[model samples]
Target: MKVKEMIKENNRLREQMTPFNRSYLEDMILVLRASRVDPLRTEELLLEAAQQMLIAQKKGNTATQVFGDDPEAYFKEVIETTPSRPARSKLNYYLMIPWTALTLLFGVMAIVGLISEWTTGSAGMFGQISLFTLLSVGLGSIIFIEMIMKWMSSLSDTDAPRVGKFNIKGFGVYIAIAVVVIYAGLYLSQLFPPFALSPWVSLILSIAGLLGLKFIFLK
Candidate 1:
């Protein structure tokens, strides 16, 4: 089945679970997504789990009975046993993430620049973008992913997952480091020989990039 269809089916079935079972399933969803398993594999695994839970529910077995009380332990086994994506697929996913980030970042700046130039006759958000700016976005994506996984790590023990589960102190420290990374990127860009992109050119590159992501890397 298509990933979307599997997900739709899973959702429709999971709703039949008891309140306790449903909450446990929701926690599983959070941990599964945060685990960074392959997207299609993740959905398939989820649908299977949902199907099992439904069958067990009819037999009067709670989620904890069939799937173990500790989600931490159950999913640890599942994720470990799950095969890793092929090296090439892994490379493509990583490359796609950064490329998507880069194009979207510059695309927004391009639009803002065009608007500013139209009204005030001066360059907008950025006068020039540098190679270091690309480095920053790439690093930022990695950092963002690490932060997310770190937070999700705590959800394994919780009965239900929610935003309140995030650690405030950890988030504060992460935000500080992120602030430093942003300034550091801006400063490093000043050290490089930067080139200007006319608003039209920037916009065209952004559009072309989205097309490339949509077609060539169509995975």
Candidate 2:
């Protein structure tokens, strides 16, 4: 199954678990997802675990009995053994987030433009997205990807689950670095001061780009 489908099936199966077992499974799922496991493999692992957990539940066994007494040790062992996905695939997955965000933003803007045209018999005056703003956005996306990888690496290096759980503590470090990159890009973009896409074009391009991203990035 695809990662998304596996995730859906996993969620559906989790509902059948006893409360205590479900809670235990969720912790494992979170740590596994946050680990260096490949996205496809992570979902595969989760689905498999959920299935086994349900079977165990029927047999009157707890998650701890099936998974381990200390889930953290299990998590560390798994991360140590499972190799991460290729850097290219990881980068593509991160890029999909900003691509989807931009697509939704542009689609909303396009709808607003249509509403304006109907009400006033004139097209809406859509503001151009500034080059500087785009630079900042692009910086944010890159910063997010870098921070996450750094956190995962930290967890792997330390073999500690607490090192980088949600990409929070180390974000300040990434932001400091991002500021420098953004300014450099801003200086270079001075050549095209007024460059911008129209509302419909932005929406169309966003949708097309998202399709490409889904095809290429999502496993």
Candidate 3:
């Protein structure tokens, strides 16, 4: 066979291979379309495909001939043709659970303090004022918590359950802290009045109460 004829034959085969390479690239794009993952995630995939296309072009394969030797062009086309990404929801309200729980739990504690003062008849004007403030703050906090819980319940089922549990647990923790603090305060006050609270006995009792709470919490 003549050398010129052999070269022509080679050229024809290369042209025929182009369509087959193009079809594979088309198939890849189709497979990517079928994927359930978000389109934004496809950026990396498109980049990889572009690199492969560039390599195929350099290798002088039929695939590169149809898609072109320029991987950047294919990457740009994929990016432009990609589906619009969905907007992410900002459910930051879930973050309010712990704060809500603390407020409600502390508010109830304040109301209890007020009642205790009233029953003992030892509360002066300042004490009454403090108690009233506590009662108001606590009641307001409870109302706020109820509102938050209702709103959360109406949104996501999974998130609502988790947030609800967090609020409950936080409230329980606050109550436990309150009980420990109150008991220690009462015990120390009985042993040493405020005027004489600087005494060694009062200091020891106060430290003992704190250490006891630490032990209880650890257990």
Candidate 4:
């Protein structure tokens, strides 16, 4: 969502809630947004907020209930009317295009470097550049993948699949796992060989993932 709109909505919600509750709700929204959760799932999000507050209350940590009655109806209405957060799809595409073009150019150069290395039995500056180029591609891909995932997570699917469980059963677990795996890969790659090759590998994988995402969701 636009920052201005988000601020307006936040202010409106705050006005309706008690001071203590408003603070809790604001914190919850910030946390959810940081965790890549959609703000559009206002009801579910608010319930989660309420639960947190109640837990705090039980522990004598904080006593705050922003709503005297159930907030379910209000949250639902907000979700229904609120527009989805905007994605920087075009900006992502523009960024990707230049990277892809550079990758193509580097691929050609790398091939020439390899051929030269075979004939000369020595990798000169061009060979180093080739390796650097590959590394750039791989690391770039990993970063890009993370960025896309983050952007995707920010989006809410109003028609998301669900079962006899809370909130798209197991979704939180999936996100947690994803976060861990991404972090692990990033950490381990720094400690491994072919650190130079990392970027190329990551770039390819990221591009493929992007294509799959587009085909599945944007098609």
lDDT of 3 by residue, 133-203 (tens): 33334344544565554444333222122332345665565566556555655565566543311223333
Candidate 2 lDDT, tens digit per residue, 142-214?
A: 6877665665444432223455355555777788878887877778678657454566776686688667766
Candidate 2 regions off by >4 Å?
Answer: 1-5, 34-40, 58-61, 69-72, 121-127, 141-171, 174-196
lDDT against the true structure, each candidate? 0.77, 0.71, 0.44, 0.50
Error of 3 at 32 (Å): 1.2
Each candidate structure's TM-score, on Cα atoms with residue i matched to residue i, is: 0.70, 0.68, 0.20, 0.25
Ranking of models by TM-score: 1, 2, 4, 3
Off by over 4 Å in 1: 14-23, 26-42, 55-61, 72-84, 159-187, 216-218
Candidate 4 local distance difference test against the native: 0.50
Tens digits of per-residue lDDT, candidate 4, 142-164, equal 55555555444443322243222
- Pairs in steric clash, model 3: 21-63, 107-138
Arrange candidates, best lDDT first. 1, 2, 4, 3
Question: How much is 57 displaced in model 1, in angstroms?
Answer: 4.9
Instruction: Tell me the lDDT of candidate 3.
Output: 0.44
Q: TM-score: which candidate is best?
A: 1
The alpha-carbon deviation from the true structure for residue 88 of candidate 3, after best TM-score superposition, in angstroms, is 13
- Residue 6 local lDDT, model 2: 93
Alpha-carbon error at 53 in model 2, in Å? 2.3
TM-score for candidate 2: 0.68
